[model samples]
Target: MADSPEDTIAAIATPPGFGGVGVVRISGPNTAALARAILGRLPAPRHATYAPFLGEQGETLDDGIALFFPGPRSYTGEDTLELQGHGGPVVLDLLLSRCLALGCRAARPGEFTERAFLNGRLDLAQAEAVADLIEAGSAQAARSARRALEGALSHEVNALLDALTGLRVSVEAALDFPDEDVDILREAQVQARLADLSGRIDRLIRGAAQGALLREGLRLVIAGRPNAGKSSLLNRLVRREAAIVTHIPGTTRDVLRETVSLDGLPLHLVDTAGLRESDDPVEQEGIRRAWAEIEAADAVLLVVDDALGEGEEEAAIRARLPGHLPVICVHNKIDLTGRVPGKQGGVLYLSAQDGQGVDSLREHLKAQAGFSGGEGLFLARRRHLDALTRTAGHVATARDALAVGAGPELVAEDLRLAQETLGEITGRFSSDDLLGRIFSTFCIGK
Candidate 1:
């Protein structure tokens, strides 16, 4: 971790591969000294200079561009150096070795961004957006992450925090002056303010839920009896033959998974073996795995033969599914049944073979995941949603306490807890373990 300003850290910033150029990044108090040792002269602040990188023995190791950024105005709010050179595994490794020899320790995963957070260059939500932007599954996701990185989410949180602080101060003032006739908790204006804050938090929570769905995506399990075109449906959704499709009843004896984007929403598609009893050990094992997948899926797409409609096997399979899991009855092979290709009453009639009604399925999946392709959505994580939920809970408690004419102290305490919960979203009140968990998920040299 980049926890100290004195401990210089370095790492190959560019991904490992032979490219036109690669970079070695170093940051800390000793960055200037390391640059002087490796480049023979310190580059001008915030300027890139073409220079020869040298080893300890004063031998030229590589020719590259050197950039220097002085502390307090850099990415990590510390002196940082970037050495750009030919992107070769051997060459980059040699350059990194030279930096280590010059007293720079290797940086941990996301240490660069972590340092930026600790140094106040970015809040927790913004820091997380860095990783989200890097690993965005779609353009919409990238846009959302960019909004979060630009302080869209943090701005909302700060505004809510300010409101909470103001209300808490008012309550405390009334508590301090018992001699005064000011009944802060019972005041209509105070109740209105609390109601306004709650409404704002509610709107933010809805947007955050959509953002979280975009980030984590939905896990959909496709299961049905043999010859129900389960594999065909999977192939149509993925736009390729991801799963082997055949006329055989039990052709597929394993669960196949493919991740695809449906209208900018990531869908983790799982195609399981046809759900049924089988004497063959392989088929039995596949059925077992299919049930396991159904148990954990966010949603299930039960593909059934339109000719047979819902039968005993379908009922049996449905009975095994987790009661809480949402199911979309997919009447596959509708082409053969002469049924129109569309959705009605929560059932989708489609032919997976000729792509009939697949678009409706895609739309249904997006709707089920609660994704709306729109602007102003900031990327958020589960923890952020949890914090917002807790904040809302506290605010609701305070509202109720005031409505019932509870003591000013109780209302103030609820407001205080609400403020602290909101602080966690922007990293103002995060635990060390939470920080470690959040940063460790990022790639090295972030």
Candidate 2:
């Protein structure tokens, strides 16, 4: 692995397989030399020049466009080279091999982006957004990731850090003058400022939760008694024959999972075995697995036959589910029961066979996940949420200390902790282990 930003690294920037064009990216101190060695002489800065890629024997490897970007003004704040050539796998591999032979080592997964973060071209949050943008599953997710890459999340974190710093400064100053008549806690608006900071953190946390949902999505478990149209509902949601639909009660004997996006939000639909007591051992094991899925699910969709309405089985399953878990009661096969196709009193009446009232269920799912599509959402991860929550906790403790007239030393320490926690979100104060784990998930050449 390239240990330092000074080390030169190269990789195939584009994805694998044949395409019209492929790009090989090189960055670090050796970029200028490597470019000159391959292209005969360094190309003008930021300008693409048609050139021939030559092997060590001075023989033509392939003709392509070469562009050079000098240090401190480039993506990684270092000299960078991009060679655009035919997308043929062998040709691209040869080009990369030629560059490696010229003293450029292969780039590690996410190393290019890691270098960008190290050089201050992008902060930690923005660096993660680069990967998020590449892996975004929906148009909304892409837009959200783009906003985060533009430093939307870092901006909020930095603002919170600044506020904490200001509060700490005031407290430290007051500590220096122990005999002052007016306490800094009272004069500096410490309590009010802390309250406002706490509120701001709360609002940011809400937005981040939604963004996280956009990224990781919700695990939606479809569960109920046997022959409750569970397979039909799963098929309808995914718009395919994903699950084996049959009138037989025990047709589905195992869990089937499919991920579907609902208006930019992703729902990991898990079609589980019917939840009913059975004499057969196979059916019993399936029910056990269904319960396991329900336990881990973020939300549950309880599908009940509209003709059967609510019954002992439905009530039993609902009672068995975790109290905190969100459940959307779905009344499937409404076309047979002559029931209205809409949501009424927390229950969605829909027909899975003909796809009636499914839109209401989708809306209810969105509402359950608290995903209200809006602008300016920053792509966030679970780690970011944990940091924000910790920061808020520290702020709350600091506020409590101030409210009770606690000494400036204690209040100041709490504020400092709060500031540090916020810094972790943007990598202003992060551990080496955290950095390694975050970057390791990215694909090579990112």
The clash count of every prediction, one per candidate, is 0, 0
Which pairs clash in model 1?
none
Q: Write the per-residue lDDT of candidate 1 for residues 167-204, one digit (tens) a residue.
A: 99988877888654567433677899999999999999
Off by over 4 Å in 1: 1-5, 184-186, 240-255, 274-294
Q: What does candidate 1 score on TM?
A: 0.91
In the range 1-446, model 2's lDDT, one tens digit per residue, is: 43666679999999899999999999999998888889999999998899998888989989899999998899988899999999999999999999888888899888889988888899999999998988887788899999999988899889888888998998887788876566743545888888899999999999899899888778888878899999888878878323222111123433466677787787877776645679999878877776776687898899999899889998987887888788888999989999999999888999999999998888888888889877878899989999999999999998888778788899999988998889998899999899989888887888
Off by over 4 Å in 2: 1-4, 184-188, 240-255, 273-294, 308-324
lDDT of 1 at 339: 95
For model 2, give the 10-residue run with minimal summed lDDT.
241-250
